[model samples]
Target chain A: MAINKLKRHIIIFVMFVTLMPTGTAIADFAVIVNKDNPVVSMGKSDVKNIFLGKKTFWPDGSGIDVYLQRAGKAHRSFVLEILRKSPQQLSMYWKQALFSGTGIPPNQLQDDQSVIKAVADNAGAIGYIAPEHIDTTVKALELK
Target chain B: MKLSRGIFCTFLFVLISLQETPTCLAFQIGNHLSLNGYLSQGYIESSGNNFFGDSLDGSFEINEFALTTNYIANNQLRLGLQLLSRDLGEEGNNEILIDWAVADYHWQDWLGLRLGKVKLPIGLYNQGRDTDFLRPMVFLPQSIYDENKRSLLVAATGGSIYGNFFLGNGGYLDYQAYYGKVDFREDSGQAQGIRYLVSNISRMKNLGSVSDFDSENRYVCGGSLLYSPPLDALRFGVSYFTGKTDFDFRVGGRKGEASGTNKDFIVLSVEYAQPDWKIAFEYSEFTGDRKALGIDIPDGRSQGAYVQLCYHLYDELVLSALYDIFYADKNDHSGSKYADQGQPDYLGWRKDFGLGIRWNITNQLIFKAEHHWVDGASLQLPIFNPQGVEEHWNYFVLKTSFNF
Candidate 1:
């Protein structure tokens, strides 16, 4: 009986070790603007609405222009970890908006550097990238 | 087609909504009756030329206004009704009967059946297209589903059967099927789909007399099957349908444009969600015949698909982007068109890239903005041809939408 109990203990311990999460699971995000813009803050919803086409103009009704890095590892991760949209739901919205004449989608840049460059020059431009990609041209707006 | 849409939207806003008041007030007599209904309203402002050469301007005023309500019967059943209107303007005279009907049914945590005037289960978006709360965008795409109001078939007429099916894999499926006849205004005087293209039922209207026009019927039968697997954060859906659509246009005084069609649609979707961040992608297509003028377009097939990526930064703010494409061709039987017109190719296609940002000021209230660049050609619309690309076109658009 003692031997059987000992075996059970071993199994449970093995399971615990196997189930423990490894590596860095924490996600980091940043709100990017043109390096030269004076605006410096935002809310999560404000960012989401701008991307979803729900808010066409800025808070003050300024013409807002949004840019994105082309389809790639960084772009994909940013969308999943920061944008909060899945590949499928976003696609459906695109077609629905386009065919219905509600709106068109955005122009895709080839990489993170390109996106950073675009957002850095335009006051109305907004986007996000990895914290490492942050440079002198673009400023990161801390979220509330 | 344009005329047919105007008439049907008008019918949806004017005709159907009128009948709802009487059904409610009639029951109000001799009762402490306080009746209320669900309300929904919105409008579409776009800038682009459509299939019919109509230009879309970027504008927004009021699109819909509705009030739907009901009464409780015994513990097992409820009686309900709705009054709806869309596309209201300041000076232009525009109104239609979008929804005005009553329903009676029983329900529980797992199963239910509703009967009366209700939304039709035509496409992924048609059933709930009018309510902005159910979707992120202002309208569902026309390539997959169109939500034009119709006068031929009852919006939520007769009855509908719905149930939940479990796949034993920690996944679930929702199924629904309905049987009813619809009122068409374009030709049958009922709008088939809402996007202003299929809204014109009068284009084929050859039937004579109001009686003949009002006497058309559309026997529609279809169902949707949805599945979400347990092994992955993925969802799948398949829809099948077969029915006889009636348009008011008459051949030999038949009083209806009776055309038979089959529908098959497939969807594959996936979602990877995490705290503070979530992303989703869905691909769907409709493959079947679009009945028109009693002709089953030969080689008539249409398809559409899109991919989107998004990031939620904070409570009401997010960033997103997408790529889209849709195509269709006119199944022409006339070996060829006039020599001057040649074989009259009607093939069409469009591809687009977009980026967007949105802010949700409140849970029920949202403000959104988006930008898009487009390429490709639509079979019946204006297009640009790149130096080496076939009929390549380019254009950009900016848009905004709000719902409460």
Candidate 2:
């Protein structure tokens, strides 16, 4: 009888912890471009190739450029969680592209606000920032 | 539908908030090691002229197929390797070799050491930048950074120390210093257990050691400082170096020994970089007789610089171009010039132009093509081809690269 009561108590405790509502959830975002971009959506793999300089130009040959914020912890984390790569890994990729004459480094902007503004104004521009920072001037497309 | 919209809004809020939160150090020592590698290929076809011995203003060929790999044992230690191949004019002619090997140790956030073979810290791109997958041009300015000549032992077989310091405004600073020798000899690629040494004056060899290398031993040091400022989008870096590349020099007949200087030249560099575009600029000149064969030929000056630009057109394409110039302030010569009356004859100034495109088929695959025009290459060897004209034979190059 004593053993049965202990087991029952353990089960109830486990249930309570497992079911508790912590109110925290993993975050996700829709990577967007200006509404004018022909691209509707892309997946993580597509984004990786685009940023890595593996893909040099756009499909239509209009040419593409970019604006990226300086490297930061939050930015790094978002890139890791969303794009699944560490900063060093990403740096190496850029290093290869930059030295090979395959592509140029992105344009650096002060913050998401500026990045959004620049990208929105230029049809050939692309960038990533917080979803909340998105304005009507630009559009956010979902990463497939 | 209403409920879905609310969920989406909450998601957006969380994403924005995450960008403002503080995070801990991501670099740490753990046994769950991670290994990374890069593969690249390049091809060139120039309507202009460049090549060793002859310049063919209109010859095009496949240039290189290469791959590199990095192995990180933990947050504190790392290893790297590179293999490259170039197919000459026909099926049987090929150039191949090991480009780098490094074993690094992290002592702290501000300092660390690397043992074994590694790149000598010279400029922003001399050692840090070189690879078909990384650069925005089909070729780095030949006038400024290409060292196919005696910069031969580009990567050394020695030790190096480096460090990084973080600054606010989303910026950071870094520096590196190195010491040691190189693997030099008739068959360096396969030779071993050889020691080399170089003396200061022309014929006063026998001063130190000479085993695997021709003859050399000297201290080396270099450093770089970078600022990103509050303008997050803009990053600027300046770098410098003073040291010996190789100490071994087999002097000709009499006074037959050579010694390289412990300190020879200095390099000044600046690099502006962004995700989609970056430009590298540098100037290198001699000092303290940093030389090999003859008593460290002091005061011979050489300087060069290049500006590169690249733009990604879309998902699978990129367009690029670069302009580079290298010449002696005292005289103009081609890539190869003999010593004349106390001065390096004339390794004329050179200008390079290029364009390219790349396509990524998948995470592990890519395809790229590029072209270059070489002009006034008076000092550069191997790549510089000579015709009657000072701007002689220029060749075109085309290559495809693959890695697993």
Candidate 3:
């Protein structure tokens, strides 16, 4: 009976992994920058680095200010697709950075609209929002 | 008693400050200044030996509290400091001290500088050892990160050059080189070891009573490099450090000095992480040479290593297992040679198998429990265990932490 229960747990775990969303099936969100910013396109690696705080400056030498949604579908999609990290992993990464005094995590907003508004007001700001939430005040980058 | 009062007051202040905003990730005074901290309390129990303060009968002597502040002067400059108070057995006693303080200047993605008391990069996890919320286990692998020698290896007061470099499609590399002097305290494990040695020497050579024991570091310097290859989620790293220290004491009203040098101290590390699980491995080796009171202690190379794995069962739960080993003298793994000198055979080595569970009760709160089956007595200092040590022992720990 114990063996059967263990086998059942293993099967369930495998199924969970198999059914998990890959995050690559659809590009439901757009990476956005301030309208005044000159950057037009970004590679996946570039976005990853910027989000990770590894890339701190733009070509114009302006500091990059990052914004993110605290929690939402768009936030999850961006974290999984662009950052290539699970939400929990990302949270742990930021916690590690904060506690170690190495770097600070990006400012998190409550939702997509807040992030979009924050990005629009800061010339050096970058954020992500669902395609339907993109507005004229922000320039959507062509993610490669 | 004073230290305990101070720690209580600090803890009260932190609690009061946190009451208003329970979910704040970091307290921000303004756009440029932020504060973060963590507090942990733990209990330990053991069978067959005492570990971390009379653990054979259970103890709550393990606890840590730290507060860090960061001020960003501009895009290129930042200042940070952390104040820490901890109690581990009879070591820390909850006395507050400066953990690390640094003024960091970032010039570019490939170049940066830091000046002040900087953390030493010994392994993949050394820099974050103080943050209990960062790992799945209550204690890190002791073979490589011996908690007893924490004061000697935690940080150094000086400067460092560091940076991250992109390698196009081949991933990236992070590097840091540092130089400074480490602080030595009378109650530190290293100092205790020196005192124990002096006591033995006093008996063997009729050197008489010893007192006023102290130690000083002449210098410490090191560098570390981490490379992430094209393989996703895989990282490889190597860190090296060397230093010299002097021990001073009085024997029979006569001053005596002993100097020790640590050479070729190195650690090699590798880790691979997936969405659900992670695995890590590290190995370290170093040679120590000492000359004390006109007697030259034979140079010995020590070795340590561990392999650990963690599985994320849920967003808030993690399970971890570790196998760690350490040899006081790599050439005498069996300890027979060490036993020939009158000490217990187990004194020369330690091997441990541990299992742990971590529950993230909340983003800012965590609970962890772990159990270990250990053989050997290398890390158990003789000064603390006057009754002698057992060849086999087991210990369990339960810890909870709150952070912001």
Best by TM-score: 3
Candidate 3, which segments miss by more than 4 Å at Cα? A1-23, B1-24
lDDT (CA) for every model shown? Answer: 0.48, 0.49, 0.85
Judging by DockQ against the true structure, name the best candidate: 3
Over all chains combined, what TM-score does candidate 3 have?
0.93
* lDDT digits (tens) for residues A1-144 of candidate 1: 999999999999999988997534543446698766666887655565566554445555465677765456656655654456553344334434322212334444666788788887778788777778788888998775
Model 2 CA lDDT for position B395: 46
lDDT of 3 by residue, B168-199 (tens): 99898999899999998777777777777777
For candidate 1, write residues B1-404 as lDDT tens digits: 12343554454445335553332122232222223222233333333332211213433433544444445453335555554444422211234443535343434323557676555544344555555433444433434442222232225356676655544535556666766765444422123231122223334454332223322445666666655555333445565544455434443444444343434544444555443354545555444454544445443555666655557677567666766666653232221331224422323555666666656554334555555555544433422111112334332222333221
Per-prediction share of native contacts kept: 0.00, 0.09, 0.47
| Best-fitting candidate, scored by lDDT | 3
Best of the two (1, 3) by DockQ: 3
> What are the chain A TM-scores for all the models, listed individually?
0.75, 0.70, 0.82
CAPRI tier for the interface of model 2: incorrect
lDDT of 3 at B38: 82
